[model samples]
Target: MEKTNNKHPKGLPYLFFTEMWERFGYYLILGIFVLYMIDPKDTGGLGFLDKTADDIFGTFIALTYLTPFLGGFLADRVLGYVKAIYIGGVLMAAGYIGVGLFQEMPLFYASLGLVILGNGFFKPSISTLLGNLYSEEPYKANKDAGYNIFYMGINIGALVCNFVAAYMRNKYGWGPAFITAGVGMLVGLVIFSVGMKHIRSANILKPAQEGDTKLSTVLLKVFVPAIVAGLIGWIIPGNIFGSDSTDAFIFACIPVVFFYVNLYIRANAEDKRPIGALLAIFAVSLMFWAVFKQNGTALTRWANYYTDRTAPAVLEKPLETLYLVEEKSYESKEVPIYDDQYRAEKNEAGETVKQEGKDIYFRNVTPERKAELEADPTKPVYLFNTELFQSVNPFWVIALTPVVVGFFMMLRRRGKEPSTPSKIVLGLFISALSCLVMVGAVWAGGNGLEKVSSWWLIAAYGVITVGELCLSPMGLSLVSKLSPPRLTALMMGGFFLSTSIGNKLSGVLASLWYGYEDKANFFWVNFGLLLLATGLGLSILKGLNKVMKEKGVQ
Candidate 1:
């Protein structure tokens, strides 16, 4: 045990800063991504339907996570971790910049592709490199705490980015906001390069071990099949999963999932149990992410349209000074309202088409509020930026991480620390309750007919934040602890694969929001899925714990 609570390696600080800045850029773009997509094209947005935006968002995030598999594999055998990190950083920066400079659909998708590929290379490599640093003595004893600290750095970026996003998008436009994301990414790359010497020792590439799965075999078996499966999904008769994108994504995941399963099946005897434990934990954890990842989708919706955004004048002016307020002017001119697809039924020639209406947000506002707005065309309403709410979950993470880490350290000192498996189980249960908190928010809002207090969103994020602290960092620590030395990065990729699946699933669920008139039921379904995962996690605890003990990980 870390009796003296020794200082972490110098490299830890460098990794922390690199990850912090990278996430700053990432979350900044993500905070406004769907909003930008669904916003009117004339207003500097993509002009996609809400469902379409959700699908793209889900696919983007999922693919971003999915690329880590290739990244990790290449890092282990071809490119060293540091080289991979640098490449990934540059690509992501360029991708962010591309999105800002281009407005065409093809260009927009290409930018997203750049991000996905870049994230694959960057994410797992840096994480594995961090674990490598902790693998040495003294730091080994504090691996979990180190991961918690590293995780805190991620939230720091996440917390700050939304404020920047809100300000940029509010003051300038969509392009400037996206450009800022690219700038942040470049800054991150600079920091990582500057700190290269400190992390150099941990970037050593591992040669293939006897009986290891060769890259050639994996390409033929997994990559080729995944591409074929995606094609099959795209060409299938109708929408089996509500959309072609969703169908393709799910189908593509099959081979990847099977690849992971194949890992366990092919493992040598000594590695089998730990691999099994990881797989099982990965399965249950998918539910946590399915619900948690909604911060970018369904929760964003609530913040945008349902929650009360009007700030008191005193607070409003100060917030505006900080560029944290979005001001909307009331105009006297009447515009055709848009249908669900955001199309007007009548053409300029007065031809028949889809129905149209005012902006959905204004249409949903109370009649009294509408009249008050209509009374003064020149008046501006200062509302808290919806993206500002994205910071809440990360804020909670920063606030609670220290407490969670300290609590566990105290437990360890008393020889009473709960095993990682136990912590994960508790996290699953706590996460389920966060869904219920949102259910209450829907109830308080009277099924979205009226605006509700902002505290409802805050409370839900707060509850879920606690669950996240227990789960996410621990999962990283678990992989670091349990992975076979040579397979560490690959296994980390597997963990992210599970995350990719959950992110896609989150998108699927969020896309269904418009279909649910009773919003509470949507949250209730989220609650039930989490509860189910929690139960499954509980059932597997004994076995997972046993494996951890066998591996001497806890």
Candidate 2:
């Protein structure tokens, strides 16, 4: 055990800044992405008619998550974590900046590809590096605390970016915001380069196990086949699964998922059980992310188009007079008030079209305001930017972290603190409850025709942040606790793989944004999904508790 007062690795500071800036860049991009895509075609956005935007959003994030499998494998067997991080950072910066300069589809796709590939290289390796730092004798005792600290740094970067995004978008426009993301990444890369000396000890590449695929062989076997299969899937004749893109992505992911399963099977005896359990946890965790990540896509859509974000007259005067907030005309002209069910579009044959007026926000905005905004041409409505609400979750993360850490420490003193698995289960259930609050918001708004107060979003975020505080940090802690000493870094990648999947699935869920007619039904779906995942976790709780006991972690 580490001495009671031993400090964390000297490398942590370097990793912390590097990660913080990287996330700053990423969140900045994510914060504005959908907004940019869906903005008016006249103003340089894709103007992808809502459904198309959702599909692209889902596909991009999913592929973004899916690439880490290759990234992790290569780092474990070929390039050390440090080199991988550098390569990833550079690629991401280039990609982010490149996106800002182009409105055309080809450049857009290329930039996204760059970001995905960069993340594959950068995301998993850094976490592995940090895991390596804490695995040693002097810092062992403080591993969980160290990770919490690192996670906080991530939140710090995430929280601050929205403000930067807001200021850039509000003052300059969308391009600056994209360019800003790239610059943030570049800053992170510079920080990492400066700190290389402190982290070299933690950057060692592992020797492959006897059955492990050679790096070159994996490229030939897994990647080449995946590419060929994906090409065919993309080129297939019919829309087998709604879209050719979706079909291709699913096909591509199949081989990667199977490869991971094979890894668990091929693992040495000591590693097998832990791998199984991690994979299990990863499965449940996907549900959490699918719901949690909506804060950006669906939830942001709600904040933008539905929620009563109007600033009070008194508050509005200073803000507008100070030139900090924008006041846009709100005749609710975005959609017609007369169409029953607020349907925005219809087919000429009098057939009811499915895609019209399905913007996620319309479910929450009431009929009265729709008419009012449409009728009143004189009143200029000053509302807070919808992207601003994106900060709420991370804001709570910063506020609640100390309290959560304190609460757990109290339980530890009483010999009643929960195991990591138990905390995760509890977190999932609490998360379900957060969605129920949105259900209440639906009820209060009279099933979403009426605009509700901002408190609904506020309360939902508050509740979910509690769940996030419990589950997210603990997942990282569990990885550190359970990983075999020999495979610590590889397993850290595995942990992030779960996060990557969940993150992508979040996009998938968000992409389905136009599918739900009633806002309440949409939230209810989220509620049910969380409850389902929670029940699964609870069922396995006893076994997980046993595993933790075996691992000798509290």
RMSD of each: 3.8, 4.8
Best model number under TM-score = 1
Pairs of colliding residues, candidate 2: 331-373, 365-449, 366-449, 366-450, 366-451
Which runs in model 2 stand beyond 4 Å of their true positions?
Answer: 1-11, 131-140, 196-202, 207-213, 216-221, 263-272, 314-324, 330-379, 483-494
Where in model 1 is the C-alpha error above 4 Å?
1-6, 133-145, 266-270, 329-332, 335-379, 413-415
- In model 2, the Cα lDDT at residue 145 comes to 79
Report the C-alpha displacement of residue 348, candidate 1, in angstroms.
Answer: 13
Tens digit of per-residue lDDT, candidate 1, span 165-271 = 88888788889898898888888888777877777888877766785767787688887899999999999999999899899989998998898899899899999
Q: lDDT (CA) for every model shown?
A: 0.83, 0.77
TM-score of each: 0.90, 0.85
Error of 1 at 514 (Å): 1.1
How well does candidate 2 match the true structure, expressed as C-alpha RMSD?
4.8
Model 2 agreement with the true structure over 1-554: per-residue lDDT tens digits: 22334578878888999999999988888777887876655455555545556567767776676677678877777788988998999999999998888878899889999999999999889988998888877788888778878888898899888878877877777888789999999999888889887788888777657644466766776678778778888999996656777677667657756766887899888788777777788789879988998777888777776578777878777656542366555433343222333333333322223432323343454667557666874567666777778778888898988988899999999999998999999999999999899889878877656777888998899999999989987887788788777555556556655665666566667666567777788889899999999999988888888878887786
